[model samples]
Target chain A: MAPTLCELCKTTRALIVRPKNHQKLCKSCFISIFETEIHNTITSNSLFFPGERVAIGASGGKDSTVLASVLKTLNERHHYGLNLILLSIDEGIKGYRDDSLKTVKRNAKQYDMPLEIVGYDELYGWTMDQVVEQIGKKGNCTYCGVFRRQALDRGAARLDIKHVVTGHNADDTAETVMMNLLRGDLPRLARATSIVTASAASDIKRSKPLKYAYEKEIVYYALHKGLDYFTTECIYSPEAFRGSARTLIKNLEKVRPSAILDVVKSGEDMARLVPDEVSAAGQGGKDVLVVEGEAYRAGGCGSANGRSSGGEMADTERQLLESEKAQGNETEISHLGQKHDRNCKIPNRTLRKLPKQQMGKCVRCGYLSSQDICKACMLLEGLNKNRPKTQIQVSVDEEDNSSRLTRRMESLKIIPAEQM
Target chain B: MSTQSNEAGMVLLEVEFTGGLELLFSNQRKHKISLPGSDEKGQPATAAFLVRYLCENLMKDTRKEMFVMDGTVRPGILVLINDADWELEGGDLYELKENDNFFFISTLHGG
Candidate 1:
């Protein structure tokens, strides 16, 4: 076979077949074009201000590794004047997290950026290993998801850095869109599709710089550049809900490469239709900015939690907590059942009149929370109260269930026969 | 690295798998594989033929679906032929040549 000329250079043999668009380019042109697109995403979104300290949430995974390398190159070439730091969360899995953090350490040196690691032990007084021990790994992801969300904020706060960026690519975002759409989690769908989820109530701002980038491209960039990265599934069982959605997206991409980006565009378009009243009050008036070429952040905080599944579960838990806060306003039981009941008339009205986000410091940790105590504090209270490792189980008969999310949870349930 | 590619001969190639796909390829990232120059139908061997060779002869893992589906590399796995995107080189139909470098990278793993 004859070599194909690069689309841009037209001189060198093309090495890359871009997934978003089927453009083929040589290595040098591909690298530049990838970086330039990311630069456009950053600039048009105004993700960073000059001299601002932004932490690259690093897991030593390919996405973060590529993100660090590209951001460093862009910062130097474009004179962005950004102080980029590598922030990692050590979930304290005996063999898993301990090894990935080493890659992050090497990345810190390789990228010449300062590194900060916040562990589950320091934040929650419980590593994932211990959490899995207590919770029996059935629903430990809920704990990790809740804890990691706050941990990233707390880590950024500790560094006195307000803005944190993650390596969530287009595929991840597209998967989240599909997951949220399937789950009917409109508020979270709105949250997930935002390039920047910024709340004045909290100092830490979260953004995804690689939101427009494709996962394949990120891995390709890492491999082509020989950027050091680690790839391993979490020691814990995977979340079935997001896994199915991810599988669907991968299959769709296989058939149509543009399907991923199309899903992202559809998510953004759907987000715009979310009632302003719903968006305005959900995250303490957190403006969900859909910046131009501003890619939506996929499971950004799922670095330590693992995979798109972690992000979906965490978002569900978050929605649960927020709804709990809403129901705390004198409602006896959660409207979860009623909300899912299509015939329930009052639930629609009730959903529209969401309770104003009650921003307050967690009584235990001083972190931002809508409840009297944050979700983490609430989970910790439960764990500390049940020290003897009581089996906590939520039994939902899968056959009669109408909610796809519930059925997914049913499948993801770790069977007792498959114990560690 | 045998460079001979006579019609009735065999092609020696370097097949590398990474990003955890090596777990299926005998937990080895790089394998030197010798494959017949032509298939049983007497047609020139191609990448699709190599995928079958790896599955039937080299794959130590039981999860064949993880690597191949519908007669091609699985959706998430990337194929690079001689440092070029296999998509540019005709994907699964690209004829295998002696001493070619084939890298199969799985993007399914956590980033």
Candidate 2:
């Protein structure tokens, strides 16, 4: 077979046939075009302000390593004047996070950016290993998801930075859209599709600069450029549902490479149709809705790197739907004055509305929460109280005991469901 | 073709796996394997033949499904023949040449 010349350069041999458009290009042309598109995403979205400090959420994975390298190159070339730093979260999972963190440390030196490491042990007095040991692996993703969201915020706060950029590409966004769509969670779907998410309640802002880049292109960029990255799956995350969704997206890409971007665009279009009242009520205390005319961007961490799996979410959705159906049936029975009226149909308007979430701070730890105690504090309370009786006598700090008691009392109060 | 002849009618090629695919191939990224010049039908050894050969001989890990599924390279894994996408090189039917380099990278793994 004769070598094909690059379509763009028309001189060098074409090495990559881009997945999104099938535009064939040589190695150098592909790299420049990839960087140019990311720069375009940043410029068109105005993702960064000149002379603003931004933190790259580094995981030493392919997405992030490529993000750092591209951002650095673009910042210099376009004179974006952004102060970039690498911020890493140590989940304290042995043989997993430990190995990835080493790659992150190397990336910090390779990129010549300052790096900050925050551990769950120092922040919450429990590493993920300890939490998994106590809570078991079944629903630990929720703990990790909620904690990592706040940890990134706190980590940025310690550094006094307001914005953090993640490596969530179009593929991740599409997957999140599918998950939310499958669960029929429009509010979260609206939140998940935005390129930028900011909360009025907090100073930290999160955005995905690679929101438009295809995963295939990103991997090709890394390979062609020789970027160093780690590639192991989290040992504890056999997230069945997400794994399934990912497979679906990949298969769709195989059949039609444009399906990913189409899904992302569809997600954004559907987000615009979400009612203001529903979106207003979706924000947890820490995540305020940013409504700009018909455009609404709410703050929430993307589950791309977080361990939150679709299985737990699917279970929650099932329970919610069952309860709602039961309520609808009961309403029908009460209005019709019949115990078993199978013929009577429940009106769609009669479906119970999600309760409006209140914004407040945890009384104990002072973190943002809808309840008097935040999720981390509630989890800590559970962990602390469940400590073996023998260890309780050895280290019963008064501060810890008093907070535990306060949280216990708070738990007794009738707190609304879906506090987190 | 005569100049590229190898001992015992076998063709030597370089194969590499990355993006966690190496974990299945004895956790080794690169390997040099010699393949018979022709397959069972006396046709030139193709990428399909190389895949089966690797799974049967090179792969030590029991999880064969991770690398290949239903007699083809998994959907999410990309195959590069001589640094060009295998899709451009006639996909699985591309005939192997002596000293040809084949790279397989899995995009399904966590980034």
Candidate 3:
């Protein structure tokens, strides 16, 4: 308990040294105000959606593992009213994903939540190794990112989920802001500007519950909980550019301890809030409810280029009608065949006739289908259009054909009928 | 000594990846840093590079903001600088001057 001769008193600014990169705070300061900000961030924003299914995309790493672990804790203590579920997407990389997958599974078991794991190999018919072979490393992030995003959306849709929660933290957000700014990606900048507001307008309404949480706090939480997790990193991520940003932040913290937080705040500030004028696209501008007609409501705010010049678009039939009404000009609006009535009540017996074959079972996704295949398979196949030109086994189980009839009686989670 | 500014304040910060959620940080002059995780040494290229960038960008005169590496694949690994999490508060914005200390750590997910 001997006091250092150079130590400063509580009131002495002269004794204070700017904390270095690795130093979080002084011992006395650590006890005073560590997690106060995090508490304020969550309570202030009401981050969690009420009585809705929240799927945490768990990667089993410190980031995602920490996220899932803390979310479960907070949900219980705070009663966030979330129907939480664990979602793990396996990109099917060899050395990288194998061990990490184990951690995700272990975490799922510990959390006592039902987990839905969608594998890229099975769903998209392509793995990272296969992707690397096809396009090389030169822009694989584009492919992986797109495919991964679509897959998450497709999976969430199949599960009837309203929101997808990710484990992105402040550092992640800041680096992204920098990367986006560097690349001049205005669309993404305009899209992701919202921290916890209007989360529904985006494709899947991804929320970063860890938006304000720090990596340090997350680690402390895990360590304090003695949570067993996979500590290794993805096998193929060494050459990524995000590595560069992490380095920059460290050096800056030496001089300005608040650099990382400043960067993160800047990113948060950069996000554009959705204006109330463009608000009609309610329900995140997406009526994911399978209630019919409502599906077309999704794209009203998708993009300016896609909409008709007159702010009206119609089918060829509608086109024919419009031409007939106004021969000289193409200004007439046509609303025929619009799918806006998706919610119109249709009794089970009145549903569209399944092309007899669609009543069969799909080889992929194990769902019943009106087209001999299931929607997941159709989408997965479409996504794999450029699937590595490698040889595919194309294996189909012998029992599948015979069991297809029996699939009707079985209550498999996904219905087999697929969209083209 | 007169009221001269502390010039040796430069920490020559370096963060090393020890293992998952574990990192080690030390100025070039320190023989050893007791930070937990891996028994690693010789600044990781990404960690060192980031520290350098932060230094120049933040207009820092010293390497006081050096952060160790937590096991993250991407470059944005969170470092505990001055006990204030770089991931939480203004990460690089955390100021550093003479006598100031820092720590680095990564995010955690609940079980």
Candidate 4:
């Protein structure tokens, strides 16, 4: 076969066939176009303002490495005047996170960005290794996921940064959409598809600048540019239901490369169909369920807002209640009627009947929580009370049983039912 | 064109794996392999044939499913032939050439 020229340059040898548009490009052309597309995503979405402080969620993996490289390049090239920082959550896994965090440290030096790492031990009083020991590795992901979500926010707060950008690409977003759809969590589907999500308090905003980028391009960009990145799966989270969805997405991409971005677009479009009342309830302090593997590292992190469902509504609803109080008796009666309508729809199993979640402060950490204590705090309380009598009881012998543990985790049926 | 005679006409090729797929191949990223110029059916060896050859001959890991699925390289794995996408090169049907570089990168790993 003869060599083909890059479509963009029309001179250099084509080295890449882009999945999104199927355009062939040379190495230089592909790099420039990849960076340019990311620049466009940032600028068009107004993802950043000049002089804004943004934290890059550095996982030391290929996606986050590419994200840091591209963001740094774009910031300097376009004169965005942004202060970029690398924030990593250390789950305290002995071999897995310890190895990856080393790459992240190298990435920080390579990219010339300041780095901040928050560990599960410091934040939640239990390392993942310890949690797995206590819980037998069957459901430790839940503890890790919940802790990492807050750890990121707390890390950003310590840095006084208002926003954190992650490396979630089109593939991750599409997987989340599929996971939510399969679970029949429409409200979460709405939140997951949104480009940006703010906590109920609206303090820190989380965005995925690579939300539209393909994972293939990310790995290619890292390789062509010679960026140092890690490439190991979390040893503890090798197999989960999300892994099945991930495999399905990959298989689909093999048949049709466009399927990944198509699923993303479909998710975004479907998000609009969710009733306003449902989205409102989602926004007003409901605890959004966290997707395993999405939180600190690759876990979906439950829609990026970090709220749970079915909690007492906090300030937002109290404001509504007070406003109703000021209105005439008839308006007050109608507000109550509206509440009854939503509550009664639960029996009918309708989508609009969102569990009324109230935003409140964690009694322990004062971080926002729908419950009196946040998930991390609650998990910590359980671990602290059940602290193993003998230290380091996490048997090394259990290492051989991880596959069995994953199978047990799958059978745990923790996946919320369609109706919840 | 006897099958035994084809062994004398082996072609040299370079194979590299990245994005954690190298773990399946004795944790070695690069291999210089010599292959029969043609398969048993007397046709030029294709990428599909190279995949099977690598698994059976070079791969030391017992977990073959991690690299190959349904008799092909797993779906998330990308194959590049001499720096161009194998998809642009007829994918599994692209015939192996002497000294050609085959790069397989897995996007299935965590990021």
Candidate 5:
């Protein structure tokens, strides 16, 4: 086969045939275009301000690693005047997170940025390993998902930063949109489609600068540029519904590469069509922003970390479905009336008065919550209650203290274990 | 290197796996292997043949599905033939050449 010259340069041999547009480009051209598109996403959305203290949610994985590298390059090239820092959430998984955090530490030195590490053990008194031990691996993703959302927020708060950026690319966003669509969650769909989500309840604002970059492109950028990144799946992740959604997205991409961006565009268009009252009701009016961040953050963490097996959205949908089933008759009658009369104010008023969650501060942790105690506090309560029993069990086996000591040492070791 | 000149019916190539796919290949990122110069039908070996060849000869991991699905390289894994996307080089059907570099990177791994 003859060598194909870059479409843009028309001189050098093309190394990449872009998936989205079939635009052939050499290595340098592709890298510059990838960074430029991210720049476009950031500037067009007004993601950051001059001298803004922003935290990059680094996981040491490809996405966040590429995000940190690109942001640093663009900041210097465009004079964005951003004070960037790396904020890592240590889920404290024995073999997985420990190794990834090492990459993140190196990235801090390599990028010349300050780094902060927050662990579930520090914030919630329970590491994910401990949580999995207490409540088995069956539904532990719920605990991790709820915990990481608040972990990121608290990590940012500790840095005294007001903005956080994540590495959620177009593929991740498309998967979330598909997950929401599958679960029939229009309100969340609306929230998930936005590039930036901020809440009045919390001081921090979160955005995805790589929101439009393809996963393939991100990997290519990291590879061509020789950016170091860790690439291991979380050992505890049980392939959940999101896995299916992800497979579907990849298959669709194979058939038509533009399908990803098209789905994102479609999601945004659909979000705009969502009724205002429905979105308002979705979060109890003014607290939609915080809840929006929660939902969006959970979607990313759920898919990226593979932490949430059923996903937090799926869990919430299940609960909502059960409750709706309980009041099925009343809702069915109201629905029938509304169908008969599109302008029926009585049904609308009753629906509006259906006891929406009023956002407030958690009494214990003082984080924003619709319930008296925030989700994290509520989860911690359960884990705390079970802590003593596990300790007692461990104490009962104290005659084997030497073996137990070795086991503890093994778990705490930083080296990646041969087997998960 | 001396064996390469003596073996007329074999081709040597370099293969790489990253983005977590290395875990499926004994946790090694790079490997060089010599393969048959032609497929079962005697046609020049292609990328599709190399995938199957690697699975049979190179891969020690039992989870074959992680690397190949439905008789093809899985969708999320990117294949770069000599630093160029395999998509541009005729995808899986591109004929293999001696000393060609085939890189497989999985995008499925989480960030």
Candidate 6:
């Protein structure tokens, strides 16, 4: 085939080899278009400093891997003089984390970046499996979530970096915007759409350079560049929560190509009209502000100790721990009656108490806690209330129950089993 | 009705919004509103009544009247008084006489 003209620079050289759509450009020019856009994003947002240290939260995922590659490229081309480090949080989930971490390490080596991997077990004292085994199916995400977030923040802090960047993309932001709207979360919808980090937010200003980038484009970019990325989803995801949001976003996007842009535009518009209550550089009264439903935390030191976590732990932890202490908290509660001892409660408390409204309900199974019996137990209470009709199981093998439910759910097509 | 000793005195309305709705309302103009009004909290239809009553009250009273909603009031906020800024008075809460101004601002946050 004759060499096609470059889309951006009109170069007649096939600098780009085998672009998916026969798109042609000299390697340098084709690259400039993409690189320049990233540079613009960083400069416009002031996401990086000339010599300031910045940490990238790499997950070995398409978005993150691309972010690392582009940031490195931009740092060199734009001379942002950024000291960039790759920070990967290993949640210690079996296939999921181990595989992803391998990619992160490889990418770090390829990019010649300094890399740091903080394990869920090391930071939070428990992996997803152990947490699941101990805490059981009622609230599996509780562990990885609280632990993963703080793990990233703590990792950034350990590096003594001034900024932390994540791989959140346009799709993710749009999904979140829709999620907030459906839930009537005006503040979050107003605040979450920016392509840059709120440099004003203190405690290691977190950002998302990919907020405007499309997920499809990111995946395509990674594939085209032959970058390593993990294809597995989090193992314990039941597809009962954010899964719905993800699906909704996908559907909306299919219906309207500009759905993501519209959502982001709305969020931006709302932000302009809201109070000056933004937490700038983590200073000001808004700096101390906290919101509900958003439990992602800036990791701090000694996160694994259990002693550092506050309210979330007290409620979920104390209840489970106190119950387990009496009934071998080591023992996992099952869908049916059986038990396996597991050790974890500190970080789970952070999960439970994330939203005061949610915490008032039992974390065990998302129910209002009345007296000592939370919703998880309350479900059993209802079962027992059936007298001879309901045979209840309070303590059992945690994994077994979840798997059982997972299998049943698969059979019923409630969620595709492969997703789990 | 022009008694200098208006025993009714000034009525103050304090409305605290739910979340980050405070930054948007920073542009309100501190002006007179002379709407004869109602003394209540979360009363529906307060926007129109407030605009009319506050306009009439402040223009007539000549006392600096204000509407105190959280800084995150919604767009299209009907502040038919002056500019709806309480900065001239005591920030969000304005001082006044009877028939002073009352403004309705919207703030939205949920779980």
- Supply fnat for every model shown: 0.71, 0.61, 0.24, 0.78, 0.84, 0.00
Q: What is the lDDT of residue A69 in candidate 4?
A: 96
**lDDT for each residue of candidate 2 in B1-111, tens digit (9 for 90 to 100):** 222437688999999999999999989999999989888888778889899999999999999999898798987898999998887777888888889999999987666
Off by over 4 Å in 5: A286-351, A354-356, A387-420, B1-7
Query: Which 10 consecutive residues of model 3 chain A have the lowest summed lDDT?
Result: A393-402
DockQ of each: 0.69, 0.69, 0.17, 0.72, 0.77, 0.01
Residue pairs that clash (backbone atoms under 3 angstroms), model 5 = none
lDDT of 6: 0.47
Compared with the true structure, what per-residue lDDT tens digits does model 4 show for residues B12-111?
A: 8999999999999988999999988787687878889899999899998999999999989998898999988887788888888778899999988887
Write candidate 2's Cα lDDT for A209-246 as tens digits. 89878888889999999999999988887566667778
Query: What DockQ was computed for model 3?
Result: 0.17
Stretches of model 4 off by over 4 angstroms after superposition? A286-356, A387-420, B1-7
User: CA shift at A291, candidate 3, in angstroms?
Assistant: 38
lDDT tens digits by residue: candidate 1, B1-111: 222475659999999999988888777889998899887787888889899999999998899999988888888889999999899988888888889999999898776
Clashes of 5: 0
A281: Cα error in model 1, Å: 3.4
DockQ value of candidate 5: 0.77
Q: Per-residue lDDT tens digits of candidate 5, residues A1-420?
A: 788989988999999977777789999999988888788667756788899989999999999999999999999999999999999999999899999999999999999999999999989888999888878876677677767878888999888988999999889989888977776566667667777766433557888888778899999999999999998889887448778889999999999887887677556545544444444444444422122122222222111111222223213222322322333243233223334433322211111132435667889998876668766776677678774222211111101111222222233322222221
lDDT top scorer? 5
Q: lDDT per residue, candidate 4, A217-327, as tens digits?
A: 998898899999888888886537778889889889888777887677556545544443444454554433323211111112112222232222222222222322333
Write model 6 residue lDDT over A350-380, tens digit each, in one string: 1111111111433553322322333234333
Candidates' interface RMSDs, in order? Answer: 1.0, 0.9, 8.1, 0.9, 0.7, 21.1
- Superior candidate under TM-score, 4 versus 5: 5
Q: Name the top DockQ candidate.
A: 5
